[model samples]
Target: MVHHTMTTNSTSASRASSRISSMSRFLVLAAIVGMLAACGSVPLPPMEVAPPRPAAAAGTPTAPDDGAPLPGPIVQGRSRWQPVRWSELPGFDTDETYEAWNAWLKSCERAPAPFAALCPEVRRLSLASPQEQRAWMMQRLQPYRVEPLNGPAEGLLTGYYEPMLEASRRPTASQNVPLYRPPATLGSRRPWYTRQEIDTLPEARAALRGREIAYVADPLDALVLQIQGSGRVRIAEPDGSVRTVRLAFAGSNDQPYRSVGGWLLQQGLLRDASWPGIKAWAVQNPQRVNEMLWSNPRTVFFREEPLSEFDASFGPRGAQGVPLTPGRSIAVDKDSIPYGTPVWLVSQGPVTSLQRLVLAQDTGSAITGAVRADYFAGWGPEAGELAGRLKQPLRLWVLWPK
Candidate 1:
């Protein structure tokens, strides 16, 4: 058995190591996908978006921020923030089993690495028996502070395989394809969000003006590597009048992008640890496991590193250090501030401006309340810096979720 242990005073350093290790496995899987493709061609389907449900009212939900009174029903400047009854959200009416599965899927989508690592445990619990699965799920759900509720709400749950567009030359190979994309941005179209619109909404404005929201930091041990295997390269127009355009790639995996944990398990890098396993592992090995994983070559960790340090190491090559897209930030409904909601996160820290949106997405175990959330700062040294210096306050308004 692999004795995954290390001694480190810095929690962040340990996490970086674990992330690096997992990334190595992810990359290997990607390579396998590339090798299997014929003539290096893998076709992907167009992105799809789920329709938003109507908002309903039920008992008052807990506030994500400090125990402040729930925000008024006014959401964006244009629409009233109707309360969403628990019944209206995704698993309210479902049986306990379905609810458990839904939570698992949501958690997997939020943080593929940790969720993937926990997959084996989830499977074991689910396989043990119905009662066992329920018990297991309940134990898992405790950390997230999730509970049954009654109400109706409306919002979209989107999933997709985002391919990194390379700097040069399109590759003919397999790559992960996005499972969903809102109809508006499908095809070669640019997406946009307006500052004016964001400014007008009371919730958005209040969130912006208030002190930076301090989310539950993603435990370093829970971090997993997202390896870019081989696939087709799709290019978008290049930045700044340059003749060369940026290219994006995708791999062929029939599984839905939302099943991130399943994807990792199928690749065999992570065991099914389930929710309890994940929580336990995180709590126990926060520092040691992180260091081991980060030291591994197959992984690429997401974290913030000091600018000076980053500059000294990667230098000019470091521009690609943090993945950012113009006008692109993770968005979520104020009511269900999903864990891991990727956001441009406009505040000063290791990443001030640029296309970085590290700490927005939420892992299910961590996601609770209408406005609660967790941000994913990429991986490795860079991610560490951002995570440490992340003391500024920020308010976020979703551009597309609207």
Candidate 2:
């Protein structure tokens, strides 16, 4: 009888211990959910922690680096983010990560809800060594391969930049092409005037009568400025004074954007359809310049902002409402990737080869689809030249806080 009693006690103790262990795990998971909820994170699904990858041999480049991979793919609006190893990223270690840090900091200014919690640590690591920063990233973040929901990972990478142009505060004989502010009726109208209508229709012109911000000499320059969304203009005031100002995207006519370059390509006017090629065609066919300009129905409006010394240091504010960093900012499909997400971008071609970190801090009308991106090339002639020529295949990976 005594022996039977002792056996029962042993079994009861084991059951009690098992209960305690289960409760501990529950409490830990509850705490995590609370933290995520407080930081405005999407409610996480039940997660299983995977084993960390084995460490590579020191000095052996053949072996892959160790990483803590997430359990499964994260489904987004227009894309799927499959968890990947840090080592899977091509040129992950080769990039000068410090160069991208400045852009990351800018993103923290208006950080996405998921990343807002990490801004403090991000700032702290501003002065940290690249190795230290990299280590922290591997420890605290999960890298996800950004892929289309229905197709392959490969996509397109184009380029854009801020144009610098000379302008007059008011209309001049030479500077006839005018850039305007948003029309008063912009909100009430679902689709506003087309580019040609605004130029020719008296009613449309009357709506934008007092909205002119500045005028430029070349009609093509005005179109380029509108296409870029923002630019720096050295304006000659009525007082014969000159001041450099930033013309920021205020609003746009709701008409769909039609690419002039694409139109030229369709017409088979010239083989090369880059901005330079378009200008060459314009020079040759000056009589048909208006015909070329009217091809794209969309018209973007702008508001002038004073370019202070501090403001001039960075590019204009992107869609995320933060000043974009040259070469580190990218315009992404918001449905595919959220603003303020740290993205690993890789592309290679004759124009350039890029494998580095960039932020999804902006979006463009043309930047649609799951894998597509528009690389922000900053401002000036060199930037414009690069922007005009870059169109290549791209791959992307996004980093999420662990």
Candidate 3:
């Protein structure tokens, strides 16, 4: 058995080393769409805001720890900041700042002049004590409160993870499903064959035939791969060896993406949009799988890459072109938060509650609005589960260099 683990975001996904169960197969779809909605082509407006609020009086740097009453909140469009001392960032003093330093370093790799210069301190502090790290942050960074645009300061949190799928290098009786690479003419063609056309039309099938990268046993795996934009396929070579390869996003058919879960929700087919609910519906209506697949005309294509040891640990490169750092990484609408900017996030949701610092390292199509974000929950089933379920009240404060 060939098992390939793939990591995905709004623009990526992954597969497990073992074949997922009937329900597990569909969960990948629910998780990816639930998190990203395939936000590859979507780009947010640039965050060309005026310079940030000047820092608090030097010695009076307000960053109180949690529970300390905040001064009047500073409202910014859809978000607001409560002036607080760095001590107010909940777990700031306790966070493994060095753990997030890697992500920071990765961001610095692409960060420009003003921000890039701060890399030295990030690297230097890795060797410093945690107390020293906290001090360094307090000296260099300013914390703010995350308030809502109108009502209470609350927001949702969701999660996504890399999935692993079993596959064969060549299609066979059981491994009938196929994942294809971008056709040479994909770019020249405006809107390529859609989900339905690609599945049924002989012409469409013929066009993509030779482009097959790998074949999976479950059709849902293939569908999830496309929706998430990238994933891993476990390939069984003729030599009796299993090698895992990533199906990174190449491009997509220009058609607008429609949500199958949303469709079922609107049609009243399923009361809940959770993966379990979607899977339950699928079990009763196996014959309508194609109908569901074709619900969204947009189809994605992939390009294969062999995962190196380092690449296996981190997620696929995000919008900022840096590898995601699990809990420390988040995808935000660039219009509200610039990439590489540090942020203090606070959210209390049914699944999780967090009041900590996270970086705006990525962006997604569905991640719009001034206060919206898609958190990178790390890898595997655990991350996918969290990301899939996270759609809760969220609030964020920019951690600008003071």
Candidate 4:
């Protein structure tokens, strides 16, 4: 829930990977959201809340009592990029290069400018030692600190994950809730039907009669899959065959993404904005779960993707058009850290902590500002738990081509 405090409610990074329903900004909020509006949190300031600022920016290269010397801000795409010494990046030497290299290999598949040329060598060096990898990096890259436009040098770091659920090919007595594919005429419509209509309207239900890819028992799990915009469902097919498949973002109803957690907070139904709290509310008012869901008018549609043995191990494609590397792939504001760029990230918070090498392999609408990022935590329940709880102060350095 803490990480979700700074997340986006619209089309998520995975949606950003595809067309998703929406593309917007993430806020430094106190929200606990899930995929597409399903169960993950978005990044935004709470309604009417403003971002906090640093203590002060001392102009000189003053050696502070604690960490590295913070630099003054310089202009960038709606933010600031300040020159900093590589020595200032904490734990750079300690981070393993193997994980980041694998993530980079995936980035090379789409190959953003200037990075493609380095891929051949990157591959050649894949089997090299970490020390050698570090040497190559230092020889080829320069570091720059990122900050908010005209603001301080710090920002928030949060995580997002793929929530896993169980499903059945055909609806059963308990698994009646359907995850539908987009209507064939979805593109022809602008603002499509709302969540309420999809749930209660006969016409809307009829519009999706034969389009269900899989059916699950829990509405919360379904919603989490929607909000995250990507998920893995362990399905029991009609032949009694059981296997896992990915439900990707096919389209959306074009309705505005509203925060269900925030709504519950306003109604005084819960104190903590988290999946646990929301589930508790649902348990107490079992009959009104649909009511809570309808509070969010937006609806996400999915297209089922058959999973390969290898694909099952990786994540769904992200905004950068590459599979996400758990703990290594981060969703950024393309305006600041362009897709395919390497980033050195550091953050310490209540729910999560990290100091590592990562790649800008995805984007999110709410992932704006110079230093913000949404760490893709990978799939399933453990990942979702981490994503929901991870909210911390972040510091980033773009490892640019020298």
Candidate 5:
């Protein structure tokens, strides 16, 4: 029997790992249509004029944070920031500003140049009233409507979460699927062996000999763990002890990601390419499971990390190198919103409604576009359900210190 203890991390995998369940699996249809639509991608037009700036604070001006002169509207690779009034933000005054403070404080752990100077004040306000926090934000920062270079302010918002599973420290009859650490020859080639080659080629398997971190019962579970990039695994050890540990993204085979769900859809295998749907298909076509698994050439490797009482409270380190707050942390395209920036997000959809402050503390490969974001829904089955179904429209406003 596998022992069940739990640990976690807030690393890059949490941001990008849920691609399997979050969007790639469930939104396969959309992905197919998008691929068809992008066959003739063309250059975008120049950005438009900026909106009117918000009214200045009453007090006399002080030098901007970082001691740099306040620049005008900024343009990013895929997005543009157009100065706008605080009032322009939807439900801005009603959000529980203090709830977001924790995420902001985490961002300050590795705040970028523009926000590093503001961390002192951010820390001081941790205990301040919600009203006070909101006031400080308006007084010190300017709100910018984040829009695409040549598109609208609206974009896609998906969701991701850490997965928890059971395992064994060593291979067993049931737990035959092995999770691996990086191979010594991982980088010997431009891109390490593909997932199929790793399974069928003796040379590829030879390279990974003795690199097994743990073994699980189901190949699909291993695939899900790899997709999530980091997960909590309850392991039954040879010492007759069961403990939970985190599997973090150590490295990958360097192959481009290919969604198996999308591949299944393309093959006319299933219309509902969500995780459950894929699982059902696998059950029906047991002999072809490898064919489905191999659809994604990319194979991610992980290293085990000990989970502690305090560490369990937060998520794996994100791309920004900080533990992510469950509801308040977000993965944005760094080119659109730099890591550590505070963003005002507004989205209303069937699953939920959100009008609050979130931190740009993480990033994912699929989380591109100016207003696009991947909401971290936390861990466990409930979070998994939400992450699986959360695909919605979104708008964004970034707050920069004045």
Candidate 6:
């Protein structure tokens, strides 16, 4: 009787485990389906499928070679362009040096006028051999060093697989696979000093002032990191501009989707303000709020300029059949790709025809090197669409400059 009872208990436990596993699988599938539905309906472009290899050919050895070296510095217009190999670049990738420099700067009694004040010292030290730089950096930072692992306890790290969905193709059984494992913990690792605290330190101030300055900017361009609050989104720009865009929520309590923007417009929200009256109307009609929000066409916008009289040989036409802002449109440096270089980009994977003539009108903090660029799709709906669709590898060439 005891043996029989133990067998029944074991069987019951196995069945319970099986049921739980089944439920987890179902939840994952549901999440995938919901994500696909949220993306809405847009016909995918033709895929450039790679040719299949035979089983015997798969094992064939290829020639041993390093990747293409950085192309030699090319000159265009007034500026000289040198290829910036990030891994090979001096003063970058030296975590200890940066940490030391940062710590020393913080220890100072006054805020260095600008962040670049320490750059020259950094450059001088970096000119030494890598080992020398490491030693020097460690020595400088040692005075300010804190225990690396000392911090407040946080939550446990978890691991799980997430399903992958292709924007250009329908979901297949193969695409659903586990993929993510987060770190074990992210504790309260604080900066050594706050800005205000750093500004007050005399030694820190003097050290920074003595150091070399590299790059400093006013009105920096900030990237949009995340949406915060109900009506604001954060922006980071190249000019060092960091701020939040406040949005105007126009929808009624019944319908939350009817929103317009100062954020939306600047970030390319509405094509135009055709529905100025819609917000007030939305507030009154709670029952029809969702319908009202859904009915209006969402639009995106970019600042418009008359296309140049330059011939169609330049590129695509504007609404009135004239050349669009030829050089002013997005472009990369030719030395980098000169200001007006037109690029044809081919994307990787299923989404095809991700074509645009992006003029490199602006630069980014991390956007250096011959291959780097910033593509500006027109603002509002157009920009949002392009940004959302731009998840694949890009191959670009300066068609006109070359």
TM-scores of the candidates in the order shown: 0.21, 0.81, 0.78, 0.82, 0.83, 0.23
What digit string (tens of lDDT, one per residue) describes model 5 on residues 1-402? 000011111111212322221111123212112110011112322323334333334553322223344357889879999887665777775788898999999889888999999999999989976666777887789888898998544676766667788899999999989999989998799799999999999999999999999999888778766766677789999998999998877788877666666667678887645555666788899999999889778888887889999888877778888887888988888888998999998877676888889998877775778888878777777666666666667878899988
Candidate of highest lDDT: 5
Candidate 2 lDDT by residue in tens digits, 175-206 = 97899988998888778989889889999999
Q: Sort the predicted structures by lDDT, highest score first.
A: 5, 2, 4, 3, 1, 6
Positional deviation of residue 326's Cα in model 6 after best superposition, in angstroms: 12
73, model 3: CA deviation in Å? 10
Clashes of 5: 8
Query: Could you give me the TM-score of model 6 versus the true structure?
Result: 0.23
* Alpha-carbon runs more than 4 Å astray in model 4: 1-75
- Give the best candidate by TM-score: 5
RMSD of 4: 8.6
Across residues 1-402, which tens digit of lDDT does each residue of candidate 6 receive? Answer: 000000011111100000000000012222111110011112223423323322222333322213545455444442333432222222222223332332222212122233234445555653344345433332232111001122221111000111111110112243221111111111222222222232356743443342211111110000010000011223333365644332111111111111222222333433332223223333465565434323312211111112233321232221112222322233232244443232333333342333332333323222234443323232233333332232233434332210
- What are the lDDT figures for the candidates, one per model? 0.25, 0.69, 0.61, 0.69, 0.71, 0.24
lDDT of 3 at 129: 57
Better candidate by TM-score, 5 or 6: 5
lDDT of 4 by residue, 1-402 (tens): 101222322222222222222111111112234322222222332212112222222331222224445445456576667766656677766677887888999888988887888889889878866656766776666678776776455677767776678899999999989999998767777898899988788988888889989999888767767767777788998999999887877778888666676666656776655555677778899887878888878778887888899987777787777778888988888888888998988887666658789998877655677877788888765676677656567888887775
**Per-prediction tally of clashes:** 82, 0, 43, 37, 8, 48
TM-score of predicted model 2?
0.81
What is the alpha-carbon lDDT for the whole of candidate 6? 0.24
What are the runs in model 3 whose C-alpha is more than 4 Å off?
1-84, 145-154
